[model samples]
Structure formats: structure tokens, C-alpha cells
Target: MEYSWIRLLVLVACLFPALVECRVRHYKFNVVLKNTTKLCSSKPIVTVNGKFPGPTLYAREDDTVLVKVVNHVKYNVSVHW
Candidate 1:
């Protein structure tokens, strides 16, 4: 009985990450704002695609992270981890 319980525990531990969700999605807006000091400047703001706060995603730990970022603005954008 003890051995069986231990085996069960090990199985549960191995599957825990799979059972849980941990994936996340984030979006931002790239804008060029003119500042008085710089004469003209541009900055990137956090936005979910186009909406505020963007979108919410969930995934399990150790899971592969796959994200697709599309730029709607005219300026070139780059993202770094």
C-alpha cells in the first residue's frame, strides 16, 4: 500500500505542470510622441494588441512559450526577452 501511494505521488508530480496552465500573452502599442526637449521622439507603450491591458493567457510551467506579435504601426519594432 505504501509503495502504491508513493507511485501515485510520483505520477501526480510529473503531471502537475501539464494539468496547470501558465502560458501568457502580452501586447503593446508602439507610438512616436514628440517631446519638447528632443523636438521629436517615439516610445513604446504596453497594450494588448490595441486594447488596454491587452489579453490574458495561462499555461503550465515548463510548457513551450509560443507568441505571435503583429505590428500595425508604420515604424519598425523589436522585442527582446
Candidate 2:
């Protein structure tokens, strides 16, 4: 019985690294405003990476997402998921 416990402890120690890992993903986003023409009108519009609707974020179960948003435009910025 004592030998069995020792074997179990060794098995768990070997598998610990495989079971625990850093599962976080990091992303950086820059927000800027530029004059764009739409519907025959020109105006400054808010954009994320130069896109109006921004980019899509993808994640999996038990995964963490870290986003850093930098504002370089003269507008109040807000991000929502």
C-alpha cells in the first residue's frame, strides 16, 4: 500500500506541468479618427484599427483575453464585448 501511494505521487508530479499552463491571449488595439467619405459626405469617424465596426474577438473555454486599447484620436473611446 505504501508503494502504491509513492507511485501515485510521482505520476501526479509528472503530469502537473501539462495540466497547468498560462492560457491567456493578449491583443493591442489602436483607436483613431480620420476623415472618411460616406453617403457623399465627409466627416471624422471613430474607428478601431481603422475599421468602423472594429475587429472580432475570438476565445475558447477556460481561456483569458487581455486587450489594450490606445486612443490617438480626439474622441471619447468606449469598448464593449
Candidate 2's residue-wise lDDT over 1-81, tens digit each?
A: 999999999999897856666578888889988689989999988888888789887776678999999999776788887
Quote the positional error of residue 49 for candidate 2 in Å: 0.7
TM-score each candidate: 0.37, 0.66
Deviation of model 1 at 28, angstroms: 12
> Which 10-residue span in candidate 2 carries the lowest summed lDDT?
15-24
The numbered model that scores best in lDDT is: 2
- Candidate 1 Cα outliers beyond 4 Å, as residue runs: 1-46, 77-81
Cα lDDT over the full model 1: 0.56
Q: Assess each prediction's global lDDT (C-alpha) against the native.
A: 0.56, 0.85
